[model samples]
Target: MADPWSKKNPFLSMMLSGANAWAGIARGIMSGQAKGQQAAAARQGNKQVADFWTSALTGGTPKRPRTSKKRR
Candidate 1:
């Protein structure tokens, strides 16, 4: 049987790539490197996720974000 953890396994490779991406994002956030636009973008993404779950569970509309201004 083929090894499930081998790099040739597409599913494992995809999962590893996602993990690497999350690690980079976490590192940036922890190191204070995700600044200004990056930080705002991250916050917005997180809010969207939270809103999605909240609305889904409560059967309510997702809350609007606090800011709509475009980041340069």
Candidate 2:
């Protein structure tokens, strides 16, 4: 029997959406780094950027990033 939920699981979809958000965060980090910012700062900023969507996607709480996208 096929698992009907594969069609659209909110958790999976939210995670995917979070992935898209992380991609933006990565871009922000890379741009900040190319300009010579501290690694720790970049990571902290990235976390904040990622949190924007993660929090929205997974209730008001921040969720861990699932995957990141490449600039294209």
Candidate 3:
């Protein structure tokens, strides 16, 4: 006969193992996807910021400037 206090609870045992496994699987998938998304967003944001700076520094329609003479 099984001891009264040490008796196994079938419901908790069944749910615990599968739930723990599922939690690990979900965490891995979510974290992997989250990391990929974060990397993509960072690259896109950096490219956009770099493009803005490049245009700000170098992009303009070229034009001729007037000459000035110094009078001493």
Among all candidates shown, the one with the greatest lDDT: 3
Pairs that collide in candidate 3 are: none
lDDT values, one for every candidate: 0.86, 0.86, 0.92
Number of clashing residue pairs, candidate 1? 0
Candidate 3 overall lDDT versus native: 0.92
Tens digit of per-residue lDDT, candidate 2, span 1-72: 988866768898899999999999999998988777567778989999899888788888657887788878
lDDT of 1 by residue, 33-59 (tens): 546778899999999999989988999
**Residue lDDT tens for model 3, 1-72:** 868879898998989999999999999999999999999999999999998898789875467897698778
Candidate 2, overall lDDT? 0.86
Worst 10 residues of 2 by lDDT: 32-41
C-alpha displacement of 20 in model 2, angstroms? Answer: 1.8
> Each candidate: RMSD to true structure?
18.3, 26.9, 9.1
Would you list the clashing residue pairs of candidate 2?
Answer: none
- Model 1 stretches astray by more than 4 angstroms: 1-7, 33-72
